[model samples]
Target: MALPTLHYLSHFEPSGYGLSAIAMVRALRNAGYPVRWTPLKRVGYDQVAVMSWPQALTEASHWLRDDESLSDLPALAVVAAVVPLAGAAGFTIAHVAPELLAAVFATAAAESAHFERVAYTTWESDALPVHWLRCFDLCHRLVVPSRFNQAVFAGDLRRPVQVVPHVRRHRTNEFSAPDLVELRSTLDIAPDEFIFYSINQFEPRKNYRALIAAFVQAFSSADKVVLVIKTGSIGWADGPFFEPVQVRQHLQQMLLRMRREIKSDLPKICLIDAANLGGRRMDALHAMGDCYVSLTHGEGFGMGACEAACAGNPVLMTGWGGQLDFLGGDYPGNLPYTLEAAPVWPPERPSFWPSQRWAACSIDGAVQAMQGVVASPDEFRRLALERAESIHMQLSEPSVAAAWATVFAAS
Candidate 1:
């Protein structure tokens, strides 16, 4: 029998979801499945041109034109789209937010033939919102990225949920020595300074407020330690506050407030505001960090921390969520936290379900985690290096290919 053409649909932009879609396409092709790639055009978000995409994704870009008609999809093809479906028929995998499932169903309903729908979704809380159950009934199958997410959805949905981990594209091994030196020079990072790097949007669940407070409380200017933060706004989802300048202003006001309360010299912070530094440049950025830190309240999959760990940086993360499936239980760099109700920030627009519980990372624990890294940098780096190999192997091309193969086979 001939291999089926995978009709993969996703946004081809700079955000996490966009990159993961590109990774999935690369993996599917490597698994010997012919693919018909389609880009999901969004209102405000701009898709990256095919020529500018990472080298691996460039090969798959030729599979189909961006404006190609999906109405004429091949008979032997299976459709998989992220979030809002593009009105394609047949086996449809909708990678969407739980709240948006109703919209996904509505979009698919426009099609005449019944498409076997699969919801590829995830929730960060121990239990998903009670309201989502009705939406869950619309899908024929459900797929999630982690066991934690699967458990959250399975019992309530009363269905077998498949766990396929996110495909991370890292160029750690490919980064040259000169690339590292140039990146360091570009950032003005000194040789003696120990760097604590973090990459995330200025979102409520990310808990940047806690991370910033802990960093200042943990180290002073005399320690020669700097916190480098890389953040930018997402056009599709992010509000005005997440824009680089606004984020910088928020950080500035925060530090100013901390200075008044603490009355002590504070360490410097370097903020890089860009949509995303993709491919080998991302590797070079990760290579420059002495340690990676995130005090996030919750995560469907902690991509930044995972990428940093894979690149051999000691990760200081709150010990909870989907990340635990990959980061493991006994990882030395795990930080301490208390499980509590998720907070309602920016009261007008809540990022989380306040009734549902998520990790509230201890400020003291974050401080201690940073201090421990400062105390014995070598040991942390050594542990991270040891885990990096296993992470690479676990998420390698063949492993991801096999996982996707299973998903398609069962479909």
Candidate 2:
């Protein structure tokens, strides 16, 4: 049979959604399935082309409403709609949004006959909205990245769901000693110092402040440990709902206070803003980290953590979401000495969603975790390398390709 043509949609510019779309498309294409990626402009102010008030209002109204013509894309055997489905497009594989299932269902309803399935990655119970049942009723199948996600949607939506763990490519060869030495020197990091890195956007939900606090606290006595944070620059306030500047300012203040209050010889801090890195440099940045950590309050899928793990680094992530499925219990060697609690989100904060409660992790917990890694640097390094090797088999490109082929065939 001729390879099925799949069109993956992404909205944000090179964001988590965009990366996921690219990874999925690349996997499918490599597997001999024809895949095309299309970047759909996010609506509202950030839209590529400026629009008049009337035009913007009209487009918003149409999005809030529905467009039946979206289903008319010919040769499109499947439409893999990432997170937020752009205003009700008619596509066969309507990858419904886990958070916005109702809206996706309404959109998909316009061409119920045209689409055969809906896919989503549900990491938490609350990730899938209550209306998911209604949405699932309209879908012939549901695709999830993990069994945890599958259970969440299957039990709630009362529909059969398939589990396809996120794909990752593992680099088998270890970095040369010279490469490691150069990387450490370039970052002004000591060869003996233990490094804990977190690569995430500077979003409130990422709980970056807690991570920073934890690092400062954990390395209070140690001058041989460093916490390197890689994140994107925060933008101006978009509306009452999204204020990136306010959040960034709050985090900056927190960091300053921590620096003053925490008496660490290492002083524990480095910020690698994503805005500063591009192309090959970005890959090098990720490759240099000794270990990757994420204490996200919520995640559709812990793609960053996975990528880090693939790069032969131990991942210190919240014990939730799709990470649980991908990491599994087979993490080689003993567990890193600490697994911190999730951070708490303050009330009245826009980042706090109604469905989410309790802090993802506290600064104290993060500090303890970092300290543990520093104290036993050799153990952590060995475990990280071993864990990478053990999981490499599962996330291999060929394995992921096979899984994608199965999903496509089923669809």
Candidate 3:
């Protein structure tokens, strides 16, 4: 029984979509599927943002560059394009916002003939826009990350909507003694100070403003605590890549404003906005954290939080959205939130519309969650360790591969 070669099309950049595509391809290969990858040109960028793939994946298949033709592809090869679809004719998974689906369908349709399209997408809201009903008609099947997303999409489309979560790539290593010392020195922190780390784009829906405010309120300058935010910016022209200097400047201004509002000395905040951070460095960053925090309004699939959990950090997240799929109801770190109208930022091209509702975290709840972690770090770490193994097994490469195989089989 020969496995069909997967003619996968996706971005190779460091953005969420790019990372998810890379993980999906690796999972498929790990499950013994043959793959012939096509690296898609990132929207609004001239050259491919990240030229390198994981070395193990490079060994798995010779990835197709933009100039390279896949005319030689085997007849039986299945196509799975990460969305925007690039006019690919088979399964299309999306990392783009659901609001952009109409445009994606329009562009893809204009470029190529209609082909069997199994579209994988996710949404953060409870309801979709009325116009999306028609756009979804173009896709053969819809796959989402959680039951939350499933219900949202299923309500609008009269098609099968399946839940296939984003894969959780395990963090590479545990903390070595040298690693700990170096991490402390690099960040200029004390050995015993607790670190609450979060990785997210500096976007409105991410709710960074609230998180920063909560952190300041939760712990004072004298507390042995630090908040490390690894962030980037998503530009209209350049897609989801980061500009470290620009992001740093923006964050610094934000911090200054926040400091003035508080009218008090603030706890140390370490901001990391690097785009070229390597895997080992990322693993170290994850390891440095005593707890992973996400005060996000919502997520289609909370990749950063999941990655942090995999790194054995006790996660303190807004108790809503796709993250609940893996974190579960019993997870101790879930922060309470209110169902508020989802915000529409930038106004011109909003990712979410006014009618939709998403979770809004209570600042009090966030502060309390942080306080709990600070009061009993070891206890939380124990719970996190217990949770980590199950999470690692549950969303590992093999697990996600199996899920993908089921979706492909049905399609």
Candidate 4:
């Protein structure tokens, strides 16, 4: 008998969900699995052109065509995508939003072929949404990227929840050397000053407000260091850009108010307002920077912090969330957070639990971490180097392939 065909259904867009889906399919096929692929779209597929991820070293790439997967690597196999019926013992695992999970199960109810979960990594929030709690009954297993997320989901889920983390690759590896001159000229970052980098989409959960407030409080214009923030007005995995006008206005107004109240004006903060930085240029930007920081409220896997930590930057993030998967339980760790009623986010996000309370990192804690990087640069470097080495080993292709193979085989 032929090996059962693997039907890989996923969201194919420019966001984290789409990237994670690409990484999974690539890792599995790269591991030598004969897997087939399809798009898990909810609407019209004609108008939009799904982007091929791993955009250029210096730019994000998009092309309109008939192809589904982008990598030059030839596919191992192709298979039919059919719905699976209950008790069919089929295999499949997917990462979908709360609203999509029920629809996914409904698709599986009759055919059962699509019902079998082969195990895939999906995101979980700081709190599980109440309305979707009932959907858990159909799932036998759930794979999340971080322990913090596991705990949050487990509070309501009866199924086994495992932590697989992200299979993120570093773009910094492709660039042979730093392009400091071009980088400085582009961002207006001076040679003498130390650079502190914060790269995130301009959203409420990232805690950009808290980070900027802390940066202004921690250092002044006289200080030779500057905070360089690379941000875009995009929300999360749903993949639509928020209005840059409103995002910019809110940030500027808040910073201005804080500056006025503090009686200081130091144009030391620089913002790269676009989201489409090329991967290589982004890597070089990281290389030129002295440090990276994220005062995020919470994370499903803290991909940004992990990327920075892997790239050998001294990373400062909220002590909680998915970063803990790599940052572990030690110093150079959590920015120290307290669970509080979840703040109302921009219109894009609607799935969090205020009663359960998400993390709100302390401003003092952020100051301590930011200042420590300056005060004892050598110590933080040592720690960052350690994190870089460890994560490099674990997230490497072979290791990730082996992990995925084990899960798929067991499934």
Give the clashing pairs for model 3.
none
- lDDT by residue for model 3 over 1-411, one digit each (tens)? 555444454555556775677677767766887554555444441222222234323432333221112222222123322223243344444334444444444444443434344566677778876655776666666778787788778777766788888888633545688977897888898998889999887766788878998999998899999998887643211113322336666667777987898888899999875453445566678877899998998987788888888777899999888888888878999999999886554455455666788888999999998999999888999998888888888888888877777777783
- In order, candidate lDDTs are 0.69, 0.55, 0.69, 0.64
Top TM-score prediction, candidate number = 4
Q: RMSDs, each prediction?
A: 6.8, 8.9, 7.0, 5.7
TM-score of each: 0.81, 0.71, 0.80, 0.81
Alpha-carbon shift of residue 142 in model 2 (angstroms): 2.1
**lDDT tens per residue, model 4, 115-179:** 45533444435567676677566556666767777787777775667666677762332444445
Displacement of the residue 54 alpha carbon in candidate 3, Å: 14
Runs in model 1 deviating more than 4 A are: 1-5, 44-90, 99-115, 170-174, 233-245, 276-280, 345-351
lDDT of 4 at 378: 81
Q: Model 2, which residues run further than 4 Å from truth? A: 1-5, 45-91, 94-115, 123-127, 131-138, 170-188, 235-243, 246-249, 259-266, 330-352, 355-359, 362-365, 408-411
Which consecutive 10 residues in model 4 have the weakest lDDT in total? 49-58
- Predicted structure 4, TM vs. truth: 0.81
Q: Candidate 3: global Cα-lDDT?
A: 0.69
Q: Candidate 4: how large is its RMSD?
A: 5.7
Ten-residue region with minimum lDDT total, candidate 3: 66-75
